[model samples]
Target: MDRQLKPNPPKRKTSMLSYWTLRYFLILCIGFTLIAAGALYWIRSTSIEKSMKTAELLGLEIAEKVTGPGNRLLIPPDIDMLVDKRIKLFNTDNYFCIMVLDNNHHLMYSRPKMTQDDVRYHLSDDLNAPRNKNYAGVTVNITDSNETLGKVWVMQSKKSLTFSTETFVIVVLLLAALILCGWFTIYWLSRKLSKPIRQVAHAAEQIRIGNYEVNLDIDTKEQEMNELVSSFRDMSIRLKQLEEWRALSLAGVTHELKTPVTSIKGLVMAVRDDIVSPQEGKEFLDIALKESQRMERMVADLLDYNAMSAGSVAVRHERIDLHLLVREIIYQWRITCEDKMPEIELEASTGTQYAIGDALRVQQIIVNLLNNGLQAMSDEQTPAFRIRLQAEGEHLSIDVRDYGTGIAPEDQPKIFERFYRGELKKRRTRGLGLGLTYSRLLAEAQDGELFLASSSPEGSIFTLRLPLWTPPDQHKREQTYRSPVNA
Candidate 1:
């Protein structure tokens, strides 16, 4: 039995608006709730304290008025009339529960109905200063001269405290409604702001999936996002250009490979069919081998070009004698030029010519320069090439000069481009146009540089400069090899 594979689920996208809205809403709600609750609690505590103090002051005033008249042992007939009038005045506010007593603590008067406990006890006892009490009160003592007359007391009910708490709750509920309304408005605004961000994000996702044609409709009124969208559009255009260039490079490589391979195959078949004599057959075979070598060099140069382009070439530096290295390169090139009969010249400034660099890569750079010099001098009368070495300060310089048809100013700028051959030169060379480009790259990798010094009707000179490495002990007697010693 075979099991079918299941497709992966699509990723769920989150909205930036909803995410930030919920986050801010919760924070606001919690913050407002805490602030409102704390404020309500404090207000309730202060209001209760203020009300108690007001009641105490009122009671004290009533006591002063009643006891100020005289130190009478018994109540006068007009005393009841006075008490009735005072009760009517005090009870108008309706918040205070007032009661009066005589010298023996007997009930003298009360605005509302007073219980026996209310008249018999002092106002201090009713103040409810302890737990498990029913009411809170404040007392004012009544006295005539030095004699104690009675006491006047005022009390507030527990029901009134409960009412204050209920009012606070209602206020908090109303405030919460207002806060929620504001939060919703902020949420809507956030959604409006995040809409453009969402569009940009979706477009980015499409681009990530190789859909380069994704267009963004973001508002240009927002400066930052507009700039971002503009940059992204430019990047997409660049990516398309790069893709086209990649296709062109692949086609060029295939065409380049076909030419050499076709030549080799035709030459091999000609020899096999005996279409050519044995001596001519050897010549065809040699041509085939030369084509093969061309293909190999093309492949190697391509690889090197890729490495240089990617910045992956590692340079290993060591102390090298520039005089010795240049001599070896010229010696090898002299053997190669024997049959071609090119005039070669070598020049050097006297000094201890030492440099720190990769010797093999440096030698390759010289070889490439020499090859270019030879190719440039193909039609010259004497076919001459010159190599010059000089030492100045801490640098060693080598110049390769050729008396050939010089490079034009227009082609000079792009001469070192990979696979770039100008219309002025031979169409078919031993290697691709990567030689100069690779040599320049190798020179740069070794902390040296290759630049065209002059390219005019007289001749062209390519200069190579490397940083001279001087050992601590050899600072003196450095002028011996100025222009090649007598040996």
Candidate 2:
């Protein structure tokens, strides 16, 4: 029976693309944010530092111009006049307040109309904020040669070297918008890429439920994904075919095995019931023996077919002479069926037509073909069965031709299918329909092919082609390691 056993669906797993994409997006956002913030802070601090240095240089130059002589502090004739002139000359945009101090650090002159806040801040007992923020200032000493006259103090207001609140707010909002856009873009792309993969996974689930007809007609941009889908489709097709073959095999085995056993039982029952006389005992016993032999042959054929299907058929490939093999098979067949056998003839293309194959398997294939040929003919009244061997190009061909009622056109195509029977009159004999199938399998497993070459009312010819064997030189040992079948 062809059983449709559906397996339970597997537990759903978490989506890897969703998790990893989000995690990576977060990491990128954090990394880029830190970089942007640090760069901004550096620019602000560098600008503030440069401003403080410029203010100190300008103050020193002003103090030099007002010096009377030597290094002694000299007050300008117009105190406010000198301060205002110097402040206007040196750009005061970067400085909140600029003041001159005497040698003792006491304030002497001021510029920019110093406010209460500025005065308190410059003269405070302790600076309250981080210098890099806004409370940055610079102080330079007024000197001439080896003497200090006074000091110049430049005050940096809280608004001097940093962006205003409005500008800062706009920058932060832009950065947030960019981060959101980037995160969403990454998420969208990940979902788009994983969509096809998800479809393939769904198809796999259906296959697990014994649905070989699941449609996988999908298009993908990736070459690897396309190949994977194609391979899956082929696997489904092969599996369906194998299931059909298995079901047919089961039915055929049951019928072949039961027929012989039933015949033996019926014959024994006839004797036990005294339905036959004692004089006919030998004939009945002979019939029973033939039935047992038939059963034994059927069992052997089934095992052989199983071995071939399982890929466990051992083949020892070697150089063999096809002419010799054909002659041996024909002789054996004649000897076995001498009581009621047709005339058999062998025609060889040459004295030695060599081929590469397993000798035992090759012999089995030839025997099977011979048996089929012999079975096709009802009696010796028909023409002789001919075994022809020839070397064609790079291959050797052996044709087993029987002169009898040829196979019908409709039945020819399926004759090599396992357990497929046709031609009711020809298949009237009680036997499993595995002989031709096994013969073809054996031939293929040996790097050879067995096919129906031609068929007509006169006869049918089954041809086998194998690679011609040519003994390799010692240097070419690496090229050939007793290769297996092309199949």
Candidate 3:
């Protein structure tokens, strides 16, 4: 049975604007709810306090009007009429009782004809008293010449402080306005941030599909946004360049490796078939061997280059004499390839200058440099390139100056990139372009650097900077060698 794999369900997502607006909305709802509760509490408590104070004043005024010059009570009908008119002055909802008491606290008169218990209820001062359980009351004494004649008592239900319709509606409208403003602010700011992110994501999709030419027309004054756009654009441009070099390297490496293999095969077949004399066959076999060696060198170069990037290639950190090492490298190179050799000069600074690096890797870097400088110039051009070594501060600087046809301004910047072949190298070389890139990686692994100090029509100066060997560096190397990790 052929079983098929099922596709996974897509994950859910929320947009930035909606996400932020909803969060802000929730926060605003909670905040506004608390604010509304507090406002209602304050309004109710204030209304009750102010209403009680006004009620006390009204009672005092009514008592003044009803009593005569000696604080004597008015006629019954007149007292009832004055009390009724004064009752109308209060709030529409307040239900109150007014009564009078003589000097001995005996009830003399009261509206609604209250009993003795009612008078006592209204006169009680305790908060939990019979009337205090549901009503708010105030009592005032009427006196003249320091003699208490009577008392005015006022009482009203506490329900009069309930919220009115107009106040409720006004408070609700204000809270709504604040929430609306908060939602709009969050949405506006979120959209501003999200638009650029969306554009970058779209460009990223373009890159995923192998389209490196991405045009971003976004403009933002924010510092972080500017940095993002700039870095992305730079990365896209670099990828495009790397893609071009990848294609060229694939073609070049394939052809360069295939030719030697094909040549060796044909040469071997010719010998086996007895197509030539034994003497000529021996010469052909030697040529084939050299060709095979060339092929082996190219393959090794590729493998070592990759291993260096993976940190799998073991590199020895040692103190090496630059002057002696440079001399040995040039001597071996001259002995191997003596044709078209120029009169080369070595300029060494005073003293035995030592630098910290891998001796074999240093030889590799110097040989590569010499090959590049020598191949750059022909007999017609100035045969003037020098190898100079000197100590600069705590570092050793070795400069290889070539007065050949100088590197082009455009091509100089990319010379150290892997598999990147400049115009000169493309025309004159027959292997992968990894010499400069590998040299730089090797230098950096030893806490050093390799760079082009200068390149123009006059010539190019390639400088290798390595740290000066000190007593501390020697101790560190010894420790590293003795580490158990090596075992």
Measured over all alpha carbons after superposition, the RMSD of each candidate to the real structure, in angstroms, is: 6.4, 8.2, 5.5
Worst 10 residues of 3 by lDDT: 478-487
Model 1 lDDT tens row, 1-487: 8999899999996678877888888888888888777877777677668767767776776676666455743434464465456546544234446677765666766656677675434344543342225566777778777787887766666445434656767877877897888789989889877877777778788878978787776665778878987888788878876666566656666777888999999999999999999999999999999999989988998998889889888776777778887887788777888887777788876754788787778888988887787777645357788888887687889899988878888999879866666666635354557888999998888888999999987789999899888765655433322212232
Worst 10 residues of 2 by lDDT: 478-487
**What lDDT does candidate 1 reach at residue 400?**
90
**Candidate 1, lDDT over the whole model:** 0.74
Candidate 3 backbone collisions, by pair: none
Clashes counted in candidate 1 amount to: 5
Which candidate tops lDDT? 3
How well is each residue in 1-487 modelled by candidate 3, as lDDT tens digits?
9889889988889877788888988999999989998998899889788877876887787667656665576535577776667667665453666677766767777766888776666655432232565777677777666767777777667766546668889999999998888888878888899999889989999999999989988889999998998899899898998798788778878888998899999999999999989999999999999989978887887888999999997877777767777777777777766666655678997766778777778778877887778777756864556888988999998899888877888988889987767777667655667888989998898889999999887778999999888766544663221212123
- What C-alpha lDDT, on a 0 to 100 scale, does residue 275 get in candidate 2? 85
Candidate 3, backbone clash total: 0
- In model 2, how large is the Cα lDDT of residue 39? 63
What are the models' TM-scores? 0.72, 0.72, 0.81
User: With candidate 2 superimposed using the best TM-score fit, by how many Å does residue 218's alpha carbon deviate from the native?
Assistant: 2.6
Model 1: lDDT of residue 185: 92
Over all chains combined, what TM-score does candidate 1 have?
Answer: 0.72
